[model samples]
Target chain A: MRLELQGVSHRYGDERAVEEVSLGVEAGELVGLLGPSGCGKTTLVQAIAGHVRPTAGRVLLRGEDVTDDPPETRSVGVVFQRSTLFPHMTVRENVAYGLTRQGTDRITACLDLVALDEQRAAYPAELSGGQRRRAELARALAPRPDILLLDEPLSALDRTLRDRLRDEIARIQRETGVTTLFVTHDQTDAMALADRLVILEAGRIAGVDRPRELYHSPPTRFVASFLGRSNSLTATVVGVDPPAVALGDTRVTTPELSGTEDLEPGATVTCHVRPEHIVLSNTGGATPADTGFPDSLRNAEEKLLTLAGEVTRVTDVGHHYDVTVQSETGTALLVETATAPPPPGASVTLGVARDSLTVFD
Target chain B: MNWTRDSRSGYSLERLLPVLLGGLVLVYFAVPFLAFFTRTGVDGVVSGLSTPEARRAIRNSLLTAPVSTAVATLLGVPLGYLLARSSFRGKRLVEAVVVLPLVVPPLVGGTMILTAVGRFTPVGSAAYSVGVPLTDSLVGVVLAQTFVAAPFVIVTARAGFGAVDERLEQASRSLGHGPLATFWHVSLPLAGRAILAGVVLTFARAIGEFGATRIVAYTPQTAPTRIGVEYRRAGIDAVVPLALALLVVTLVVLMTVLRLGQTPGVDPP
Candidate 1:
């Protein structure tokens, strides 16, 4: 492990900010700490940076116990949420600040790595917002620290600039191969940049996994809802052999049903599925025949839970439309599709693959 | 100063009130300086400066003020920084003590200093034994000026250090610079302009310090003390030129300090 936080807990007087968060980041791997604001994400970053000593627990850097070390003694480079570039210093000077030897060579290389060599002579105030972030990145990287901690590096920026800088940071992290711990509230940034994601809620680790796995098979409901758009429907178990659950009058069963080992028949549970995983087929307006089931729904040979519903709302969200389908039993399910959505009040069928439903009690 | 009215009426009291209220105080300050300048021309200033008494006073003021300012900068700046950045058991008490000199009447402050270091006191006797008398000497003048002026540096430097972002210090530390280095490289530079402003104000205060200096040291006359003595003996005509010389010197130094404060390289754009 390049960095390990062993049961790190921090308290600000009476209020507990972080409570026993233990995790490890592998060498050369970029691990993201994903959480909502005030979930102790920044506190954890501060702990690793040695700005805050945890009320309890140890911080290990390359297997060395650095719990009592001050920030200057620890070889940790940090980029705060806001630009911390020294206002009085030019980009080159700021980058050369931490080096004791070969200052100019390291400064030039780091500035070039961030593509900020052209603005090396400019003061922090002279650069644009993106350029300031880039300059800060160069300054942090110039020291060549063992571990890099980025605390919401791409926040408070416009969408285009944020995405561009996000990609730039990912590229630099890869190029340097520095063990990095990225902290962000934005799931998109975390999912796009991290090798593994540690999801925090209320200062506790809710789940830790690869981004895709965590999003699809979240260990907790907080992870499921917070990671992406999810539709949660209450269902009851009808059988255990094939792991069947009933959505009102409709029975759906699949061998891939999870969280069903301790569940008995007639047990109430909440099933969650991502909006994009549910396929919607329009059954109204100029159908060749009204057989009460669309051909697209009938032909699905996969274990599917089919629900007959009417389109209650449709929102065009740039690349995709979110069609909200209200079933006959009044269960609302959101389906995301790139195809043209049926108008509101039109009849539709929601086809949900059985494996996509993540049930929780 | 009349211009075309846009949103305002020509006779509106709202627009005129500020000028009227501010102009009253402005006239109060301007009338004295104006009368003195109109009464004494350049010839008078030259003749006054040529006098041995005026030259000695000028030399004395020039020598003591800078030393006092330096003393204030050296001692008060660290105290100011400590007040700004740290918290201790008696922080509030320390702040109050720092401000005590500023609020106390100069004569009372001089009397307070005498109580601690009078000739009969142990501190004064020790200094006297060492061939450095604490009162009735140039050292006394410096002590009086520093006692009166040091608070300005302490107050302004505190405010300057307060305005500096703590995150910048933290950033420097994380960049592999220790706390002392961070203070030298980041906090000191960031707060430089404010501390400089405080130093300038301290010098101005020190040069003009009279009441305390008069009580502490009467032998070596500063410009203000000499002006007071000369005025009593020879009336307004004799002192006008002296006062004008002092005014011109103070104004020149003030202007130079202000100019230095705004230097392009030192100050952030």
Candidate 2:
């Protein structure tokens, strides 16, 4: 079923929790609402589930207006962060609870769907964290809701279990073709599980796009920083071409920015460069002077703008070395390096390719 | 550091204090009842039991107490649920009013009821028209007992309902159960223990009620009233056996009810 929210707003006294937010979820599509704590992601989901009546706006379920309907009449299934299985009931009983309420047969089939048929006789206390989460899922799915709402469903599990169940939940969503809305604070989860991601910030939609597009070309600095680690540099735009931007002694070009026509001659802009895009040079052969890059350095200088500093720390973190470089400008930059990492107090020049730098106006 | 010996000593002392205090209090209360039983003996107790007045009092106590408890449970449980779950203007005031009976002197409560249900009032006149007299009747005793005891049930049941997770109820609602079904299936079962505890407490309170019964309906002569009458007419010696019998019966019932409360899964037993 397609779920559409139109101008949904909510308030707790003077503080607005959600404000004029509107979004849609297509049938068989899993859309994730990603935001930080107190960002109203959960509030929006609650509104959709009819738990919270929106102060304004309407909720549409497959073209039917269910704005004023009570939660029990909405027929939407929800799996909460805390596994809300009835504590006194066994796993089987908890899973069958919704089904029995609907007077449906084949309760065992629902248990089998979440792979909890064996643990059905076990109480919630006896079940492992992942097992309990699975049981909660079974309970939610047993009713065959038109829309499934998951509010940080995998957050309570440990890392390994969270990763396992996240994949399991995605798989289940695909198999059942349930129109699903998942809310989570983890960006990795949103990117991995959601076909489309809606990034919310301060009770409003910051951006909404496909996962790949959102990661590759984030619309705002907030989206860019929230999605992954990016080195931000403040500079004034000196010149602009279709695909190339010239900033105070530095110019970077990217094909993704080729169609931009709004760049002016002199304007303050923020530059975003992923840590992986910066190439560390021992011989300084790939410096801006030699490679036609707009900016160049005389040596590893001790200034903030200069990507030149002594390595204060070097710790190998399995896949990458977490390198902390301190400059004379009193600014420190945390860089992730996968290649040869310098030992502590070692000097190295950092080279950033032009195409790898993203300039945001 | 000799930690093991110190720990053992501390644990033993912690265990001993409550046991010693509890045993002392038990003997203090049990001695008089025991004295009454022994002085009357099995033959005297049997002879006391054969009295028509004793039989009527026993029937009155049995008949009135359970009926009062039932009335309290029927009215109090739903009121408790509402108090716990809903938010409204003057909710705290409402709660205070419900529990007013608990703090009001039992005689004062009986007087309040008498004024409200006596022949001078609308309720009393309606009851008189229907040939139902609440004053000096068994029904009056039951009503007085219920008034004094209902607050116990309401308070316990409110706590029970409050202990239930609202999320679970919402989850049930989302699963297609209506409001009433959700209450029946999720809310009540989860709060069952608290409700059972409330029932036992209300029953005990109603059975032991003396002041209200005395003021409202002294004619039917429930056990407590009868014991009071015997004490007045023939001194403590004359009423000791009946008092002892009532005390023994109430203690057994209370212990059984408490055991039921402590039972796992089903709320006591």
Candidate 3:
């Protein structure tokens, strides 16, 4: 079943909460709605679940118009950020609450899916935070709804619990094969769980792509800044032939922009590349004072653009080092390194390839 | 001196002031009830219980008060839910109207009811012609008690329903339960304590109602009305036993209701 929204827009009084937004999710595909807080991801999910009515749009479930259908008729199973398990009821009864006639077989199956079969007789208050979330998941899943809506389901749990439960949800979602829409503000959670991520900005779609694609090729400034740790710097086009842009005192080549032959020189553009792509090496030959047209990046002839900087700070983050370098342009670029980073005040060379950059006007 | 903390155990002068004041107030309140046992011995209570008028009033109050309480709960629970959940224009005004009965004097409410359904009025006459008179009958007593006591249910149940997270309702709805079913299954059960509190308060108010009961249906005397009648015909000494009997009955009922409300996770017997 394909779920689609066409030009969905919702307003709270005169203030718009969700603008003309449209997206589609295929059957059994887990698509994540990712954004910062107050970006209308929840509102969009609500519209799909029929909890909220879009001021102007159509919601189609499997090519059938369900725009006017109430939430009860929409067959959407939702696990809210907070536990919605009926407190007076035991875990088994909570799971079977939506089963129309207290059917126990489906309830047992759903509880087994969340690994909560042993705690069936316990009330919601007796369960831990993660256990309560699992119970809520069982309750929502027992009904076998057409669509499953998870809204920040593991957000309230601790870090270790959140990771474990997020993985659990992903597994359950795959096994159930229900068309699931997971909404979260956590980029890491979205990347880890979603097959595709829809990044929203101020109630509109910023970008929609697979997590890796969006991570490497964010189309907008918001998406670039939101998806991961990226250093954004202003670049002015200094050459059109082979497409080279000036980065502070050095000229860095950008070879990946499509139709770049016609891009005029002196055009101010914004370019961003992830911290891992920015290669920070100890300044062995070129000092901060040593300036040249084409700087040496580890003495390689591969023409990788290099900039001179001094290491400002270094912090080991288990698998990598977060080396903060202050370049001549007064921009602080974060570079991730597997090797031991130089101490503060050591001059370093930051190199990046032409194809690793994302340039936009 | 530590204002909130006391060094002595149960015999400090610091605690004695508030205790003394509380004692004075308690004495002021409890002296009248204390007089019930002192003034009326077991013989008087048994004699009062044996009186035909007192027995009739007790039976009448027991019947009518429960009817009004049941009716109030049936109507007030939904109204409380609506008030707690949704926002519309004049919501504050609607709330004020609902709670007006609690704020206004019961005598004033009784007078208002009397004017609306006093035999000559259109509704009153139509009911009277149809042999369903609203005045000087048990139905009239119930109507008066419902007006005064129903607000207790609305106010407490509103607090209960308000405590329910809206997300729970949304989750229930998304789970294929309509609004009514969601209320019964999710909202009502989650807010049972508050709803039960409201019903208990309504029961207390309805059973003890006197001013409105007198104006609407004085002939079908409730417990309070009988006490008043006995006081006027005889004296306070004669009515102490009846008041004591009413108190015992109310205490037993209140205790049962509170016990039932607290019995969570246990199957209904």
Candidate 4:
């Protein structure tokens, strides 16, 4: 079923927890609410679940308004961060609890769905963390809800288990074809599982787009920084084309912006360049003449920006070495190098790629 | 090394003082009860049990305590669940009022009941008009016992209801059960242990209730009031056998309750 939230706003006494938020989820779509702690993501999910009523808004389920409906009346299921399984009931009994209320037969269907059929007789306390989470999910899904709200379903597991359950949860959602809204602070999980990402900041939507689009072309600085690491540099605009910006004898281009109508000459602009795009080389190498400039001329015309500093540290982080390059500009730039990293106290030249720099006016 | 030994000695001595004092207090309390039991052998116990007044008192105590406990559970369980789960205006005030009897002395509670349901009051007059006397009757004893014991059930049941996770109830609700059905299937089952504990505690409190029953309904003598009356009329020897009998019965009930509390899977009701 389709779920739509229109002009949703909620206030807790004096604090405006959520404001004027609107979004929609089509059937079988798994959307994610990505935000840090206290960013009102939980409030938004709770509002949809009818646990918390919005001060001003309407929740539409399949074109029917259910804003004033109580939680029991609304056909929504919510799985909390902590697996709130009934401690008194066994796993099968817990799953059957919701079914019995619906006048459905108490079968092993739900237990088999979550792959907990073997442990159906186990109590919640006897089950492992992952088992309990699956049990909770099965319990929530037993009634065939129109919407499923998952509040950080994997936040309680360890790193390895979280990765395993993350895929399991996504698979379950896809197989069940439930309109699911998952909330989490972990960006990796959001990217891997959600069909669309809705990043919330300070109770407001920072950005909402497909996972890849939101990562590759963030609409706001907050979204860019929150999604992943990016090197931000301030530059002055000398000229602008459809996809390139000239900044003080340095021309940089990015695919993020297709046109530059918003830019003005000499206006200060911020540029974000991914670290992997920057190429570093030994400074004494001969430069190709025909491709760019003559070797002697290139050597004579020193690289406009060169930071000469001793490397304070080099950390081998699996695929890349994080080189701590301290420049005379008094700023420490963390440059990732796939090659042999310079040892501590060795001097190196830092080169930033022209095409990799993303200009934001 | 010397300082460590001295410190250890000091700590041991400090621990010993409380243990000694506690042991002494235990003996002080137990000596009278032990003496009573010793003086009243099996014959005296049997003789006490055979007495018409003693048998009547035992029957009254047994009959009224559970009846009052059941009454308390019937009224207190739902009230406790409501107080624990729902939030409305004046909820805190209502909670405080429900637990008010816990703070009042049993005799004072009985006095309040007497004032409210005396022969001259409207309720007393209505009962009298209906040929159903309350004062000095078994109903009065049960009412007085319930007044003193219902709060125990309410308090314990409230705690039990509070211990049940709200998410469980929410899950049940989402599964198509209404609020009341959810309570029956999810909330109440989870809180069963607490409810059972409350029943035991209320029953124990009712059986031991003396002051209230003595004030409101002295004719139908429960064990405590009967022991008191026997002591006042015939001195300590006459009351000793009856006191021992009451103590034994109470101890057996309390032990049974403790055993029930120890059983696993008896969650809050």
Candidate 5:
């Protein structure tokens, strides 16, 4: 582990901001701390950066305890949510600030790394928001710190600019190969950028796993719901042979229930699956193209638990359509599809793979 | 959309109330200056300013005010920064003490200063036993000016330092600078304009100081003291040139500081 937090907890007077967060980031791997607002993500990052000392526990940087070290000696680079670029200094000067030599070559190289060499002479206030963020990244990276921490780096940007900068950050991080710990509330950014994601809720670690693993099989209810647009359905166990449950009037067998061998018949459980994983098909359409799921998942139709419902709403969300279905039992299930959705009031079939289902008590 | 036309022609009661109220105060402030400039002819001003007493007073004011301002700045800036950034027991009490000179009447403050360091006191006699006298010399004028004006620097610089974003200091610290280095590089530079504004205000206040300077130093007359003496000896007309000179000096300093403060950068919050 390049950076490790050992049972780190912090309190602000009476309020616990971070509660016993223990995690590690591998060398050269990008790990994201994903959470909602005020979930202690920033506080955790601050602790690693030596900005705030944890009330209890230790922070180890490259096997050395840095819990008591000040931020100046920690060798941790941080790009804050707000651009902390010195408004008095030009981009060049800001980048060169942490360098021991104050060499122009090194400053130019860092500026070039962020593609901000052209704006080197401009002050922070003079640059556009994206440019300012890039300059701050360059400045933080210039010192060549042991680890990098990004706290909501792209949260303040507009959707278009955010996508552009997100890609830029990804490219920069890849090129630098610096061990990084990114903190953000945006699921898209975390999923796209991180090698692993740590879900935080109420100042505690909810779950930690690879993005796809966490999305597909979240260990906790909060992680399943917070990671993506998840449709959670209450189901009662009807059989234990293949582990089956009833959703409304429909019966479905989910493989995830196999983990709990002790579950008896009539026991109630929550089944979670992402909206995208729930395939939608317009039953009234003759062509199979109207089937929203890919051919691979469709061919394995027998492996799916199907539900019959009426389309309550169909929202066109650019690249895809978000279709809301109301099952016979009145349970609302959101389905994401690339194909055209059935109009509201049209009959539709929703199919979810048993393996993709995450069941929790 | 037609803001200009509305403001020019509408004159609604709501707008009229503020305009009337604000205009009264504006007129009251301007009238005295208007009368002063118009009543005292340019010849009277030039002749009065050229007099030996007036020249000495002008020289003396120029000498004492800047030194007093420098002394105030040197002593008050660190105290201001401390008051703004640090937490300690009696902080509120210290803040109150910083504002004491500002709230106290200058004559009463001068009397208070006398009790502490008057010629009869230990400090006063000690200084007198040496070559310098604390009460009757130019040092007394400086002491009086600093006592009255130091509060301005302390209060304004405190506000200035307080307005600096702590995050910027944190950023500086993260970039390998320690606390003191962060203060010097980030906090001080960001608070520069406000501190400069305070220094200018102190200078202006120090030069124009009258009541305390009168009580402390009577011989080495500052511009305001000279004006008072001229007014008593001759008339208001005799003092007009000296007053005009002081006004011009103050205006020039104010204008320069305003221009310096307008530089495009991170202003103190």
Candidate 6:
């Protein structure tokens, strides 16, 4: 592990800020600590940076115990959420500050990565918001630390600037191949920048996996709901014949249920599938492309498992329409489509892929 | 900007109130200087300035005030940073003690200094035993000046240090600079304007200081003290020219400091 936290817990007085959290980042990997505000991501980063000492556990950098080392000896590069550019110094001086070599212009070399070498002579006050952020990044990069920590670097930026900076960060990480930890509450930013996402909830690690895997096959209910729009159903197993569960209308069975260990007959389980996986249509379209009728049909013509539902609402979200389908038992689900969805009261079929359904016992 | 709105509704008696209040305050502040300059002719001012007593006092004030201010800065700046950045027990009490000189009258400060370091006291007796006298000396003036003016440095520098973003120091640390290096390279430079303002205020206040100096160093009369002595002997007319000269010198120092403080990067908070 390039940077590792082993059961690192921190407390301020009696309030437990961070619990027993353990995670590691491999060399040349970009891992994102994704969580909402007050989730202790910032405190964890501070502990890693040696600003806040952990009340319990050890911090290791490159397999060396650096738990007692101060930030200067730790040799970690950090880009705080706010641009902490030394406003009194020019961009060049700010970047050159970390380099101990005398009479060397390493400032230009670092600024080259952020593409702000041209603005090297400008003061921090003179630069735009994005320029300052880039300059700060350049300063942090100048020292060439093995581990880089970025705390919500793009949160303060506009969407367009964020996209640009996010891509720049990804490109820079690739070029440097430095083990990096990016902290952010925005899932999209984390998804765009990180090689792996560490989702945190209430100061504990909820899940850690590659971005796409976490989005699609979340192991926990929180992970599933948090990753994206989810349509979850609570049902009890009616029978183990082909592994079927009694949902609102029919005993829905998927081949993926075989992988479920505690999913015996009569077991209560929650099954969640993403909104995008669900297909809604009036006709009996049974395939992945064809959405079946909105009715409780146990046996379909194509032997496909379908659910009875009505189109409750259609919301236009710029590029697409979010079609919400509610089952007869008031279990609501969403389906996104580029085309307009059928109006409310129109019957639609909620399609589910065998692989998309994630059951939690 | 919007003339129609101003004519229709904005130009009311309420709007006239602020202007009237501001004009009255401005006139009140300006009237003394206006009268002083108008009363004293150029030749009379020059004649007053040409006096050996005036020259000596001016020279003494010029020599002593800056040294006092420098001493204040050297001691106060670090203390200010500590006050702003660090937490200690009874911090409120410490802060109050730091601002005590600012609140106390200059005469009271001089008397307080006398009580603590008078020839009869151990502090003064020890210094006297070392061949240095506390009262009726150039050093005495500086000591009195510093006591009254040091609070300005600490107050302004504290504010300046407080205004500096803590994240800047954190970033410096993450970039491998230690605490001292970070303070020198980032914190000090960022807080330069406020510290310079403090130093300037200290110098100005020190130069114009009188009641304390009169008690501590009556021999080496500063410009303000000299003006007081002249006012008693020959009345207001005798001291106005010297007062104008002192004011001109103060303005020059202020303008120079203002220019120096206005560096390219030192933007006002």
Per-candidate interface C-alpha RMSD?
A: 2.0, 2.3, 2.1, 2.4, 1.5, 1.1
Reference contacts recovered by each candidate, as fractions?
A: 0.69, 0.67, 0.76, 0.59, 0.67, 0.84
The Cα error of candidate 6 at residue B155, in Å, is 1.3
Candidate 3 vs candidate 5: which has greater TM-score? 3
Report clash pairs, candidate 3. Answer: none
Candidate 3 at A191: error in angstroms?
1.2
Q: Model 4: per-residue lDDT, tens digit, B27-139?
A: 99999768767876788778877899998998899889989999999999999999898889999899888888889998999999899997788998799789876788889
RMSD of each: 3.4, 3.9, 3.1, 4.3, 3.9, 3.6
Candidate 1 deviant stretches above 4 angstroms: A237-243, A254-267, A284-303, A306-310, A326-332, B1-24, B261-269
Which stretches in model 6 have alpha-carbon errors above 4 Å? A102-105, A237-244, A253-269, A283-306, B1-19
Interface RMSD of 6: 1.1
Each prediction's DockQ?
A: 0.55, 0.59, 0.64, 0.50, 0.58, 0.66
Tens digit of per-residue lDDT, candidate 1, span A140-234: 88888999999998887899999999999989998999999999999999999999999999889999999999998898888999999899888
Give the Å error, residue B233, model 6.
Answer: 2.1
Models ranked on TM-score? 3, 1, 6, 2, 5, 4
**Model 5 pairs whose backbones collide:** none
Candidate 3, what DockQ?
Answer: 0.64
Candidate 2, superposed: residue stretches over 4 Å from native: A100-105, A241-266, A282-286, A289-306, A327-330, B1-5, B8-39, B251-269
Chain A TM-score per model, please list them.
Answer: 0.92, 0.88, 0.93, 0.86, 0.91, 0.91
Between candidates 1 and 4, the one scoring higher on lDDT is 1
Of candidates 4 and 3, the better by DockQ? 3
Model 3: residue B39 alpha-carbon error in angstroms: 1.6
Model 6 per-residue lDDT tens digits across residues B29-104: 9998798778878999999999899999999999999999999999999999999999999999989999999899
Please name the candidate that would achieve the greatest TM-score relative to the true structure: 3
lDDT of 2 at A74: 82
By TM-score, is 2 or 5 better?
Answer: 2
Grade the docking of candidate 1. Answer: medium
DockQ winner among the candidates? 6
Tens digit per residue, CA lDDT, model 3, B1-269: 54564655655666688899999999998987676568878888899789888889889988998999999999999999999998999999999999898888888888889899988899999999999999999999999999999999998889999998888888888878899999988889778888898998899999999988888888789999999998999887888777887788888988998886773553242
